[model samples]
Target chain A: MRMIPAYPVRSVLVLLAPCLVLSLWLGMPSLVHPATPEEIGLKIATEASARDDGFGNFTATQAMVLRNKQGQESRRQLRVKVLEVTDDGDKSLMVFDEPRDVKGTALLTHAHKQEADDQWLYLPALKRVKRISSSNRSGSFMGSEFSYEDLSAPEVEKYTYRYLRDEPCGKLTCTVCERFPVDKKASGYSRQVVWQDKDELRTWKVEYYDRKDSHLKTLTIGNYTQHLDRYWRAGEMTMVNHLTGKSTVLNWAAYQFRTKLKERDFSKTGLKRAR
Target chain B: MRDGAARYALALTTIWLAASVLAVEAHAEIEFAAWELSGRVSLESRYFPRTGIDPSHQSSNTNGFVLEPKLYVEDVEGRSVTVLPFFRYDSADPVRTHWDLREAYVLLFGELGENEWEVRLGADRVFWGVTESQHLVDIVNQIDFLEHPNGKVKLGQPMVHVTWTADWGVLEFFGLPYHRPRIFPGQGGRLRFAGLLDNERVEYQSGAEEWHPDFAARYSHSFGPLDIGVSVFDGTSREATLVCVPPACNPREISDLSNVLIPYYAQIRQFGLDAQLTLGAWLFKLEAMHRSGERNALGLQQESNATELRGIGFEDILGLYREEEYVAAVVGGEYTFYSVFGSTADIGLLAEWNYDERGRQALPRRQPLTLDNDFFFGALLAFNDVESTEIKVAFLTDASRATRTLAAEFDRRLSDQWSLHVESSSILSMDPDDIQWVGRRDSFFEFHLEYNF
Candidate 1:
């Protein structure tokens, strides 16, 4: 207003010159060459495997809906409480909310590479918990369209992967990768191919093959929403059976991770009387 | 002499032709067979005071045992086949001749144009229901309640059947006319034919037994995270027509003759719906059924003295009567969880409600009334894998003054194929005023060693 910044403007410009130069110098390497599809795909896979939420313990509530091609639908409300989630691994319990009476029942899984994962389901009606075998993981979970194999957290070591190519996916370029199941006896699929966004490393689609090498199903994940600045998760996953013409869609809501929880909260004594 | 020789030569030629035909039929070979064997046993003990208030003056003891074995074999040659089978059983007490030949039969399978078909002349479990539980449906083996009451057990008989399968569905026709020791009269001694269709979204079956033609259909779909299904059936069973009617000349005497015997002339209808959903860490399931029927013989039992005094009129008295209608419904669900505190733990909860009503055309003056109302709840918790060691407890109540039962069970897997199981059930009458001590008692226990192959 009073010609106050004439002297200050030059001085500020002089001060910004070095900072601008430094930024340009620092960004020069990335700008010179974009990441190739293979490099980008590997980077995404590695990053997802290495991510740690730092909650040590946490809990989440979710509403799940399954829709079929015929437009029929079913819904359930679920709560998962995490007791110990370290950079190395995690342990958690889950329970159902609706139909009112079975609200407090829970399931626990302890996963380790050296041994078969230990799993158990707590039933309120029986007031007893039953151990489930790892071999039985492929069976239907409570008669839902999703099998137990679909619900369990997939450990990165469960499969081995190789980058395939760059593929145009919708309006964006995506890196495609092929994954083969490492444990042939334990897996339901012989191999799977996944497509991920080149820039963000978000997985967008996957195709699974049966043991006979026949294409079995295709799954598409969408509706990405950012959480906690660096976290992104899909809100919907649709799977279609190639041979049977049956399809299932999973709609998820209220996904959260990283809250302070403890091992004591997931104990047998705790399960018998969980609220 | 020349005439006799010519006749002998003709007979020899006929025998040779028949032998060749038999040989060709026997050599048309495609054979299939499978066998399944399962068994369970447990030990139990109980304590009850002579008086309701006296806890100290009580008595308790325990014992249990069981054994079961099953086998099946089939032979198919070209268009013809045969089957043989057997089952062995021992439970709680020892009995003579535990082994019984359960099935024996022959069949023919072939292809006509692009369609595949089969004709079977033997015995097999008739198809019915998405899930089998004798408590709810029929065609059961009468196994102990521990096993799935909803599973269909193979019961053998003499039958002739034809089946055709295509991309759209399957159609079948059958006739069974025989008898068995433990089966109801109409069930074992009747002719039956049925048709079935199975596709990705739906399944249906329809058939005629000696007394009725039955029809059933089920449709399923997925929505969001849940799977849902609906099923309906008509004319449930041939055995449902056992109610005797009084003779025209003698209203007081029960007549053995049936007034309505044509298939589907009288019918029973049932509808069911079920859903399963998973949200987060919880799994939810709901199952329900609504059934209504005409001329239901199973509900025509004679009223006991106590039931009669409970406002049941003289016209409602048992012998040889007809009911125009009846209705029943049940709903239930279960939830389960596994592992707490990093230890191998499992748990679950279940609840169900059942209601039944019977209309009164035979009850003289009283209108249709509620026959029974039942509510059931159960909870299960296990600490270790049953393969190593496990324990469980369950409670059930019938709110309509029938009976309440409390049970506990433990199982140990001694080895890869061997296991030890123990269980006990305690029954209590809600109305203490009408206690029948002998058959309806304090507790029952069982013990068993099971092996799998």
Candidate 2:
């Protein structure tokens, strides 16, 4: 202390105090080392979400193809309209177009950040709107391998994330992480391992673990296309069930953005008016 | 008379079509799409294990075929037209072999400055209620009884419906012009009464008869977790009160007293409220209604006091068309277990309590059939398989009447365009003194195969 200059020592400690506080706030291991796994995982997820902000609204068509263990195939088609909410989760209206039996059925959902979503169903045969419980998120969607929870928009508040490692995913370097659902009592999975590309933070694949920590299913997303030069969307998503040897493939088409959709377009009345 | 009613309906439809065409022509430069055609055909087979209480009604098996075709067109100007025609042919029951226009409507919906509005002019179906066991607030459409004993089917109602959406709630107003008479089973039909119902001698409390104009209004809104609706209806009652005039049923004689029951329609005013609250995995539903101007059991005594027709001691069928008031309610909840036992399937347990002020003493069809002071418990199993399979089983019991019924319904998709449905109901035990004792031998199993395009 006597050998060093007093002014230099005072200035260095003054600057290092804020850094030390910020590092601790961010849960970093040390100043010389990288951030802790939790910080890195959150950073990746937050950045990935930031990349998809301010889309306004969109409309798309999806054809779901389901295949059983014996190679039997069933098909369903639906049209989806989405509206972005500034301070909350998005709102969506999905209307079935194929599977003639339920042709005019529509589902409307208003997702929330820290609470259960609000859902309503329009039954064309009854010409009535029914408010449905959203707690059945783990149940299969339209008998497909994809559950309702899997199809919903993933908000950062719904899960807790942890970083695993950085590894090579195909030709691109990727960050592997794990996330546990916030609603542990309602979720069917204990945790999910995700692989996301480093450059654009595009999710490449996901593996789901059941409550008992057994591998349950794997989801692979491919054919990424960028819209508006800012948003990356997957054209194909395949979910395979390991326990039942069944799989469902969702083929998306006609991706449109900024469709001038309003909040009233996602209301209960809108559900009945959907074609 | 039936033919005349059909002609009147056709004339009204033609006039509406002409008016809509003129309206469309007034809108310049709006292109409409070509008419699209779609619909379904169904083949059904129903079997009864026990013979009917009436010896003459001996048909234990029957076959039916249905054809429903739809035509639709829409324009970019928020205008659309839908036409659906339905026809069915029953092998055993002549009344079941009938045809009707299920839907034929012109819908125009758009925004008015800051508000949204929709107008639908023509025949349509509107259903309102939250409870599953009994739809107390659903008073818009007339039930198609001959289509199913469960009364799930409805005939198209001719109306001019308008809906206005505001920041507060949605307000819907309906102007219904015509009433569809409830159809009954023929003598050969399994679910028919002890004798044939003479529809040719139908009576109405309103002098306007079947031509009486009806009005209904509903206001619905949704809060954070609750959706509620309040409705008011002023119209002819859909359920007919049967008046046995002369030569009433003798307790000793079990047959040959036909054409004595006259179906009477009453003008009524009904106020209803339905609400559903969703919390976590639980859904609570309530539907309550207060209706006036329908006959009750007490009216039977009033009839004997005023009319020349003496009461034949058949208290169930001899109620006079007197103005009476009553209240009914169905309160229930459903709790669902998602992915139980580590499977993708879901199971829901449902329980409902049905209450009627008139209780069991009220005549049949005055309130919900078989639901006066009753408890219903049910379980729904959704396989969530590739076939979209589902099964629902329910149990209904009335302690006062000592009656019990068990029913099961199953449906699955055979393919994208094909489906199959099966339903069975069994009356395990019933009190002979109960009004519904005639249905003791009415247990049946039904199968339906449908093809859609």
Candidate 3:
């Protein structure tokens, strides 16, 4: 067998070294320039917000059961109407139907992407409309565990997020993340941790921490169903307040999408006529 | 009870029964399914710590019950009608054993000139004011004075109201064709100007009397955080100050010195403006009014003929009979603190200044300045529990008069259809500068039970 001279082989290797190094340097950016955790979180949020667009309008009925620490429970029933708003978040109206004392009570909310939302409460007894202050958004809703802020649809710009990790959540794999409210004064919670399933990118659970940074509440969402083959909504949501040992369960049913509701249907006049 | 009263009772019962049946039936033809029937039954008992001002008081206490039944019907085409009847009975006073059709109206809405237009025709009540302490600017409804001293109750006014809604503001035009006489305590009632109001001696500035054709217009709009309202009223004043030949308050009662207070309804033109500014957790409110022809007892005395003024104890009932023009305003605000007491409760502090530039009242001498010029401070605490319990305390004081009025109430819902309310009130007065509550100035505790359906 004939062998090339060792010196010649060495010379060729020397000639190729610089070229290999140059090639690797040119390809490094594509593999190493991964998105930051924040960028990934924002991407997920933006995707989620965009996914539910074009629903136009929808209506649904809900039943809420509130349980105090002593295990005593009371139930309330209401109907909700929602209208998709462009250049903003969404508009919604809630009218209570049962619990005679509060019947004919209605609430109107106009959510915004970058500003505090607008809210109005119509109490039948007074036959008047009262506007809720923006700073008071964190107050309890109708004496329930939920708050006025919680009733509003989540907007992408209202929060800053950090992607935490991927983990198994029930039957699906979820992308976990942490969110800090952009306007602290309007939120009762200092921070929140949420888990969103990867398949449909729908939120499955959220953990809220009070201003003191202690765990205050846990919200679990389940029984999700899709409408218009695109929009997804949970049929059941349960919120348990660890600090108070109280829990509220909301069960939504009979969701009707693309109801052709117009802006007029969400006006103050509509609120007064909600019955 | 009179025959007419009994007839009204029977008719109301039958009507309510039919409405209940319709509300239960699902017949789409008659549109019964679209009608809603609702009502309330309440039993309230008042215990006075002392005998009331009723110089003729037979009892120091009172037990009352009210049945308010309402029905709303909507046609398939969207036109709607509402009927609300309020029936109340009081054991202590015959004047309060009455029933009123608080609201019976038909509403229609449509679009006109790119603006949504709505009109209501029939007997209805319209309130216009921003003050929590008094309804100074609410002049549309004839006050039900016999019900409560603070003037919250009202008698329905028959009128046609048209509202034009635009993005900029809401413009309302009102045509009140008939006037309803204000109710006052009878001879045997606890609170009375004299012994009773002379129902037959009432006078009206308008020649049309109770059939006066009154009109008003209003414009209201909101800009960002501020809401503003401007209104003009030209009509017979719903507020009737009285004139007596010799006041029932006079120590020496005369056979010719009529004990009856004669109501005088003045014709006037009024301009009003109300504004509210919304800030984070705070709301600021202001209400102002300018009137041209309000009756002033002092002004009247200055114009009275010598014979009419002879031997009259004018100073004792000073501001009761004159007519004057003036301006008035009320300014206040409410501040709320969230999550009070480490619970899901919110506490709200409210303060208000009620000022009548003239510092006037009917029969000012006897009326004093008890509530005319006062500072009102109140607090409301709300619990976010399942029952949504709440407690409110309010105090009104006029430092000059050295008089004060305190009102407190506690409310809680026992169930979906039952509720309990406990309320208490007292007015303190002193000397020749007597408070109008006078003999009726007893501390009152009320226990109220209600059922809603």
Quick one: best lDDT, which candidate? Answer: 2
lDDT of 2 at B415: 95
For model 2, how does the per-residue alpha-carbon lDDT over B120-218 read when each residue is reduced to its tens digit?
A: 888888889898776778988887777876666888888889998877889999998888777777767777632456666677778899889999999
lDDT tens digits, residue span A45-93, model 2:
8878878999889999999999999999989999999998888989999
**lDDT for each residue of candidate 3 in B1-453, tens digit (9 for 90 to 100):** 222433433454345445534543444444433888988899988887776555355366789999988898987646677778888899987877777777777666776665777777776677676667776667777766666666777766667788878888888899987777766666555655323566656678789987789999988876767777899999898766656555442323311223566667778999999887878788898988898787763223333433354466634343445557887777999899988766788899999887776663433211223345778899999986788799999888874666776889999999878989999886664433332434435567888899988
lDDT of 1: 0.46
Best by DockQ: 2
Rate residue B28 of model 3 by lDDT: 41
TM-score on B-chain, cand. 2: 0.92
Global lDDT of each candidate = 0.46, 0.81, 0.74
RMSD of 1: 20.8
lDDT of 3 at B412: 92
Sliding window of 10 residues with minimal summed lDDT for model 1 chain A: A136-145
Q: Give candidate 1's chain B TM-score.
A: 0.53
lDDT tens digits, residues B26-94, model 1? 776444443323222222222322222211321232133323332333343323232333333322112
Candidate 3 Cα misplacement greater than 4 A, ranges: A1-32, B1-33, B193-195, B199-201, B246-258, B297-320, B362-370, B434-440
| Model 1, position B348: C-alpha lDDT score | 61
Number of the top-ranking candidate, with TM-score as the measure? 2
Interface RMSD of each: 17.5, 1.0, 1.9
TM-score of each: 0.43, 0.91, 0.86
Kept native contacts, as fractions per model, are 0.00, 0.83, 0.51
Model 3 score (lDDT): 0.74
